[model samples]
Target: MSEPTRRPPSGAATLRADKTAAIAEAVLDELAEHGYGRLSMEAVAKRAGVGKSALYRRWPSKQRMVIAVVSEPTVALADPPDTGSLRGDVLAALHAVADWLTHPRFSRILPDLIAEAQRDDELRRALALRIGEPRRARMIGVLDRAVERGELPPDLDRELALDLLGGLVYWRVSARGAALEPGYFERAADMALRALDARPRRA
Candidate 1:
């Protein structure tokens, strides 16, 4: 008789992934409601409808759990919002990010995450990968599309241009530690466009 077929535990893995996702969402809500200083593992576990041991099996500390929750992948932009020009593209992206940050939960949670990052290298690295790099890449794609269409200078330093565009939003967020006002993104986009499109002034 042939040996019994060996099978991977795909169902178990799927269940674990689903449970982990639930835990992460619960942790995010707790962090948003109570802030990191006051967050409790037991509360998150209870809220997620999982046992404490299960939460502990996945994450050993509140810091790690919070990092995982905050770094969850965001929804992609809808249709890339082409307005037939580079400035329009930049404005669209800025508005998207601004709208995300304007949410009460995100605005409250992000500052706590940044504060945690200052104290924890592992969390900081995770944030850089899950949040920082992806955001930078998306902005770069928008700029590259503009360059390809002759909307922006082909020789423009894309990395610097991305920084010029993204850094302004981060600056306000990090500095003010509050929800951004309307028109803030538009103003930042205007400034970034001027910087990117400026001509060399004749001396």
Candidate 2:
């Protein structure tokens, strides 16, 4: 059964909640329109219709704000469900990753961040910790499941496996500016399975 609602928010509280949502939207817009290096607190503040202090209250710095906002949805979206087969699991994961990397806003934001991170050591560390690590951990869950179910070799080099999972799609979507066609996910999945020397299973 669904949980019942508690006391509703007061008028002032509702206004605050709405304002915060607006601010988050503004941050993503600012990030997408302007790369991290060029994104400014003033721009986000004006776009959000809130003073810069409001942003400061939420995050101490622009880097923290960008990482927190981008990381939350990213980590959630990349989680691959257990699909009961190595091919199915890998295919599902690749499709999820492709969707995320190709989403209109994210498609732009990520490449921009990647370029900016190359020159900014602080951002590089934050992106790896807050975004990259969490998503990789979820992909590891998929690998561990396959190993236990005897679909993949017991001694799978998991780091390489993780790289294989996203590399193809990420390269096409971000590096080459290539579009993914129908059945591309399957091809990528097959390649990853072959790379890891996965055992064949009955359909």
Candidate 3:
């Protein structure tokens, strides 16, 4: 008789991938509802419809899980299209920031996490390292490309430029609760580029 047909190993891998995705969704929900300070693995497991052991299998601690869940989205959203010009790139990057800041779930979770991070040194460090630095680096790369293309001054203060770009969006969308109008991203990019290109006023 011919050998019996054998099942491929894909079943277990697919199940694991589904479970991991479910856990990530649960983490966002838990963070939105409870804030990072109050999030718990048991609660996440319950939310995900998976046992706590599944969580432990994926992450050794609550901190690790939270960092992974939050940072993955943050980094992924930091990516900006080249767009062939500094102005276009700046607008694109600002729009990305605005979108993330104003996202339904993140808009709530981010401010709470920032507040909690102020009191929690470890959490602050993790966020800065995993989310803040990577996002900033990408923005810096945008500026670098502009300089290489002769669109921006080589002596441009890239760090300050990134700050202005990010700070404006954060303040308007996250802090001031201002809604981004149809041309807001374009207008903001124009203003930021003007500021970046402006020469220092001598007394």
Candidate 4:
């Protein structure tokens, strides 16, 4: 009788995870080097040392793959630290934003992606839905906590507050090319708190 068919090793799960991570890292590098407008699945697969089929197995399209690879880490890194005070929380959030914006790979990738998104509706929507919305929700939670703690008004304009926090850092670091000085986040936090008219809790 024929022997039982030899089964593949049980390492498939681990192998898949490793390949996924490799592909993600390769995607970032490709985007940083080539920008979103020039990125291709072929390039990413070659960079990752995987077959193009490996990428297609994971993501159905280049847009989906790029968005997932970029947005997952971004949203993960964007978890605002709960410092139990609006001022502290604001500083933590801004610091995280500064770190990401100045990161070597992201610093290169983001500006190009932003420029491309301006002209590509599909890309714009993917960025908004995947990266923008999650980050905004987190910031809104930060503001909601501030309100609960009586540190901000119940009717605070969360959208404007988000704009203030993100805009200040983006303009300085990404747009204007200014260096982040020591205590920059603290100073920005103070300014943001003042702008939002944040108040101290009552006994």
Measured by TM-score, the strongest candidate is 4
Off by over 4 Å in 4: 1-15
Least lDDT summed over 10 consecutive residues: which range in candidate 2? Answer: 1-10
lDDT of 4 by residue, 1-203 (tens): 11122222255443477778788889889999999888998999999999999888777899988888888778877889899989889889888889888888888888888999999999999999999999999989999999998999999989999989888999999999999988777788889999999999755
Ranking by lDDT: 4, 2, 3, 1
lDDT of 2 at 69: 75
Q: How many clashes (backbone N, Cα, C below 3 Å) per candidate? A: 0, 0, 0, 0
- RMSD, candidate 4, Å: 8.0
lDDT of 2 by residue, 1-203 (tens): 11122221245343365666777778788888887888999999999899998778777899998887788777888878888898999888888878878787788888899899999999999999999999999888888888888888889999989887778788998899888888787788888889999996634
Between candidates 1 and 3, the one scoring higher on lDDT is 3
Residue-level lDDT of model 3, residues 1-203, one tens digit each, is: 11122222244453376678788888888999989888989899999999998888777789878887778777778888899777888889888888888777787778888998899899899999999899899888888888777778889988888889888998998899888889887788789879888422223
lDDT, candidate 1, 7-77, per-residue tens:
22245453476677677777778888988877888899899899998877766687766655555444343
TM-score for all models, in order of appearance: 0.74, 0.89, 0.87, 0.91
Off by over 4 Å in 1: 1-21, 57-64, 75-83, 177-185, 198-203
Clashing residue pairs, candidate 1? none
Candidate 2 accuracy as lDDT? 0.82
Higher-ranked by TM-score: 2 or 3: 2
